[model samples]
Target: MTASRFLDVIVGVVRQHLPAGVSTRDLDGFMDRNRGLMESHIQRQLGGLLARLPGPGSASAEDPELPELWTAAKRTAANLAAMVVAAKLGAERRNPTAQERATLRGYSGWGGLSIEGAASKFPEGFPVPEARGLIHEYYTPSKVAAEIARAVRDLLPTLTGEEGVIHALEPSAGIGRMLSAFSGLGFEDLIWHAAEWSELSGRMLRALYPKLDLYQGPFERWIRERGPNWTGRLHLIVSNPPYGARGAAVAEDPDREYREKRAYAYFLRRALDLLAPSGLGVFLIPSGFLTARTGEMLTLREKVLRRHHLAAAFRLPSVKPGGREALFPGAMLVTDLLFFRARGGELPEVDTADRGILEGSYYREFPRHILGRELGQDAGDDDQTKKPRWGYQVEGEFSRLPRLVERPICAECRITPLLKELDPKLARNLRMGVMRTSLDLDGDALAPISPAPPRSGSAWTATWRSCRPARPRSPPSSGASCTRRCAPG
Candidate 1:
């Protein structure tokens, strides 16, 4: 039988004999018990086909056609195992029980490839393995990881004085995806270090990095106990840390306190502390880090934003798969390399004007390009500009975080000349309307009352009339008529 036919037969037999509601392990055990019979069937069918063609010693099996058949047979066998596992897992729901997970983990070794040897195995291609069993999560697509790595690599030379050996660290390295990209960038003798909390994942990383220095434990505990030793040593750090919120600890401990902070924030603070005087760091962080109002987020921003200048941020197109809702929208956050420099170190003088640094603006409007698009608006009134007359200026000419953080004020408050002509009560209502629609009050109001100040034109009368309560109106000629109209129904 051909490989497809052979697979069909095995699948048919499995479907016929598979126990109802059988656990994955039990199904695997059933297959194992029948292994001899299955192999015999496969070998007999393949042997007959080989006989019809040339023998291995003869020209038939040696023919290119025969080799393809042999390769297909191996592929089919692998696919058969995968299909069986998938079907069994689907039937069971949660990942197979611990025994099944362990069994699958061990069986994974049968079809594994070395990460370093990947390029050679598929000489004409990028060698990313197919998602298999539990190893799927560890695999970061090479194309995406390479793009992020290149962005970091471009910034690293500036931070490292153009020609120094750079020591990089990835806290949750998982199968070395980011590290592989780092190695490709020509860092001399890259001292790759990683930590894996999962026992199976740790084994996989060790296998991939035989000589690599690795620590296997919960990241927070590892950092609290061991991080100080590496302080002032690392030159670069990058990571795609875990996404789930840290759970309440079983016991009250300092390490639990460490984990209580979002892992990425903790890693960021740690990277800043560990970095060499002239080091650089890039992180893949949730976009919430930019606009978060929580105390932890505010504190994190206060510390990093003041010290580390924001170099670049790429708001990536959503690449997360479905069912992974907890994974926050990610952006590539690049911070200046100078943040790690020692006090009074010889540093390059940055032109505040040329670099586009100013109060109430961010660097996002600079000439920096991303994914082939220029950083900011082109010619027309782009979305970023144009603040509401009743609201604080939303978009400034420059791009910087510090410039944008401002408390909302009633537009009619007479503390400033700008606020003197506007109606504070009307502005407050408009602000409330903006908040109700989940829009920013700074500029993009959902229900804009008036295009400009009410005093600008006769159009303001219609706008004012629209906002008036639905109760009875007073006589038109008196100013009291306007006041009574403005009162809430």
Candidate 2:
């Protein structure tokens, strides 16, 4: 069941049926585009084509990258849809109304080794979990997990009783590192649901987050089969989905832009479909999703912008070379923490420079060194005044609610971007007054009503920018001025 072995067999079998001179590469693209659909048909009609192919052979038991699980993976396709369809019918959605946000204080739990601490139960020689087609399994760091949880907390509705019980889903829960962030946040009535393909990872996750509604299978299957049941109904989705895997299928966003085989892109496109209209999604994906120049990636970006408002974005440094860094323990895959809200973000001008901050050009490049320097002048190191500490540490650079441009989040809610703490504990769930935001919208666009908006959890420094009208009738006095109203996105 090795990928190369199976690939050769599948390709050889398909070649016999190839029409005319269409090369395998061309057919490869065609198959890749329709892989999801093909897999669906195979799941239902497994006997015809699959039965002809050879079954898996005995392989080394000690293989780190074991192919033994590949046989089980193929068998999963047959019952994947049945498994999701037979699961608890339609997913219940949770939405709350009108909450205020007093203070958005940041949390400091990075030192806890949240990712490592949760996986402390795994034995030293535990085999890598690849049964779920997971080629990349980097755990989310605690600092990153807390930041994602903080963003999710902002968009949550303050529902009580049955409605208050938040129905949440994490597409991939490796040992519950990200799931634990949901705890201690005021949302005590959270119903956790997660899908992990590896039995080993599932066992570890179950031990860590007892409340999780665990789905032990590939995310593509669970999301594709169960997504419709929860279509536009889930309150929140937080995940650090797998990266760089192929042959994923999803019923949602069947278009090629959404179907590109990049595992992160495929997972995000489908998972996003299940988000409640006012729900929030916070994911950690490769920066390529944000910066890739490919046409498919570009289309995916546009699709996201058209539907959801890009709220907050942070580009995390990749793992330092030589693997001594304590952050991400996998490949040097530069990642970004992206927060998307149902609505109410300033639209960015495509192809334009800094005007549209979310535009690819704005984030065309990022610092790649390990992030060790604390943000802002508050970092009390004696050499803080020194310039170009490049070799010393990499500064964290991010922006939150950085939507101040030609079009504001309506005129009333438009306030100066202030540097504030991120810990929600310091503040009440404050809601800004309801106001109609004016963004280029189609028929279904709702006036963006946002909560205590999510802020850039990792900002190198905060500068005051005015959100006043383009042409001010009267300039404010020097001492007290409304000029420094908002911060740059």
Candidate 3:
């Protein structure tokens, strides 16, 4: 029989044997109890098929058609075994756990691929496996993965109850490291599911977490097939989704008019759509999500603010000592760990402060009420000059986190008129092109001012003021020091 026919037969056998009135819990228990017996039955059936078609079309047969028939038999046998495993697991509505997965692996070798030096055994024109997408193959740092897991663990209690099975999904589960992190946390009866686009990574993940509800292929296609039932079913969603690129077509959001459809944006939107009303989502996303003015990025931000309760944003370091990048290694990518929850009951309050700096790292909370304040029309009316970076600030610092301010003074724009507006004289002096200060990489003190391009990756502005320094005075409270005034350059 063909692979499809074999699969149909296996599924039929499972359906015929399934007991009526069995609850999902009971079904799961039943499958576990009968695993050995189920394996034996499948083995026996496979053995029968093999006996009838052993070595397909004997070597003595001169017909060319005989070899093709032989290939089909071999293909059907492997496919049939895999189908049996899938059918049994489907009956229980659960995936094979590690041990159960290993048991199933015994049925097939090379995962449908011919073993090395065994290629002559199969058809000559067998298709080669497609190459995996480079965007989907990016590696997530171990420290970042552990940190995200910890954050998810802290947020889980807020979104779910203590008992019963809770489902968690990793949309881009390369190598299953994130899944392993969740498993290590010891959450009672948690179900791990993943969707990986790379065949190689998916294989690795499947090998590492055999019982994973794994989907191998583009996440977008998998979402389309499985999404309808996933609505409000997932308790937690965590991922370091692909960035910078676009994926399979996504229906335009008529309401948001989102123009940019980068892969990471789609992944985030899908994750949110799949999240239960009380679910928590933790993502390692580009820092630009907070500040990018592109229609798609803005639309995504607005959607997040309006739909979810923003909990905390942990701004991770983009650069490291010895002039190396942290998140993307050879490339510079400023990243943030965002933890948010779908709107439900009251969200817990946190202690934060305005423009707070904690050990050179930035952390902020985004309460729902003030979420769109920064994006509001009035907030940007004064400048009309688009500021490239923006972030939120919590009401207090460290001790008592309370309210949140949607737009806080960004470090790069501190010396700009935006921050000194309250003091018209100072704002005027700064905007008039005053003292220019360039960064001194070796020292903390303000070096001599000159007109030059700012050092790459350094926050220091090459020209602070267009004219000569008037004099040194205790810097204004606006945080711009080395006060001076000069004519516009």
Candidate 4:
């Protein structure tokens, strides 16, 4: 069925049975992780039942809406059973593929694989349901893409391969702005792999990179399936993931933090997980990932710090005057041009998830939130033993400092995180698709390839107004590079 039709059916089901809250903003779709999404769908439906009832401030159990809302919930649950049975009967009429079966298991489990030893590839072309209704998808304009690509150009040749081919993946390829940046640079032998949730975007990417491996579905499912095989095989991974969207919850990860349902979190975690040793990743994401301490985000910091090489994370202007970020709808978000690499061995930490201490500049948080209660507390030091807070207040400071801001408040940023550290030394390699034999020539014997020189098209300059609210703002100039952040207090 067409994606719109599927959505229509979903909407119909929500309106018919769970009419109290028909919107599926909290609904989950099929994954490439489609099945996990199905459970989310059911969960959202259940939530709607509560929505129909009288909320806070309403009189008690005798509320008139309770009966109708309760009935809607019951009908919804019963209708779901009937739909499952009808779907099963319909499936028996024609032969269904294994992927189809896995999708049905959505009411059951979540699972896929394109790994060499795996059974099959991820279910292709499945419409990824709305992970979280909060996802506001915006395309990266070419001007912005160019700026980002220039920064990534330098991080390339550091990850050289024998055949000179680079394997890169754009987990959320929308009209291929990132792909264009990839080819625009000096590289030609890129092994393009991309996934998109919508078929319309998928078709566009297919036209752009016809021969490249293009998978259709939610990226969470596609990448997880093939992740085992391609893990550490992709030299560079680039993406502007959907911000604030929910993803399938991973329940059994050892770190406990890996269970985040935030779509960007899922994408970033996987992006870091899939990079080959020293392979780079360029991401345009919300600034919050670095500073967020709630739930899994803190441990996610540990993962990013320990598992990946510390690279530059430049704050982008969210609302620069005359800048593209300012012109675009929903543009006033603190954004960042984040860079990192896959570290092979033990990597070091930039900061900690420590609480109360609040010493770490990047990741610390206050012991108690400033809920603005009438409690007589001050942001200043304890009156009994006052001391300077080093500009980091011991109270009321929260995690996710401005979430990372964009510059010019409005400039477009085109970037490329071109990386593929195809180490033949690693037991398994990408090009060879197997364990490397002794006969294979290590890249060391091959002449070294340098990063492509920066291409000059538009002036590569950007400026953001001084963040100091009361300070007089400086007029931005052409070719102005203002990366003044994290200065010592």
lDDT of 2: 0.44
- Candidate 1, residues 1-489: lDDT per residue as tens digits? 233324333443454355678654575567557856766777676867734542111122123332112243353343334334434554445455545432332212212233343324321221233334122232333334444553444344434422355666777775555665565323443466677665445544454344667887656655656664554456677776653344342132253323434555665655554554435566655444543345555555555543344545543322222322111112112112111221111112232331233221333553232222222232211111122122211121211111111211122211101111135554454444434443232211123333444442111223244433332121111111122122111
lDDT of 4 by residue, 59-145 (tens): 112233221122333423332332343244344554334444322212110111112321132223322212221134345544345
For model 2, the superposed segments whose C-alpha errors exceed 4 Å read 1-135, 154-162, 248-257, 319-326, 344-359, 363-489
Task: Supply the TM-score for candidate 4.
Answer: 0.45
Q: Choose the strongest candidate by TM-score.
A: 2
Candidate 3 lDDT by residue in tens digits, 94-129: 667755553333322232233434444333233222
> Which candidate number has the best lDDT?
3
The 0-to-1 C-alpha lDDT of every candidate, in the order given, reads: 0.39, 0.44, 0.45, 0.43
For 227-300, candidate 2 gives per-residue lDDT tens digits of: 54655446678888876555534444443445656667766766765564445677887655665555655666
TM-score of predicted structure 3: 0.45
Candidate 4 stretches greater than 4 Å from native: 1-135, 248-257, 293-296, 322-328, 346-489
- In candidate 3, how many Å is residue 95 off? 14
Instruction: Measure candidate 1: CA RMSD.
Output: 27.8
Per-candidate TM-scores read 0.41, 0.47, 0.45, 0.45
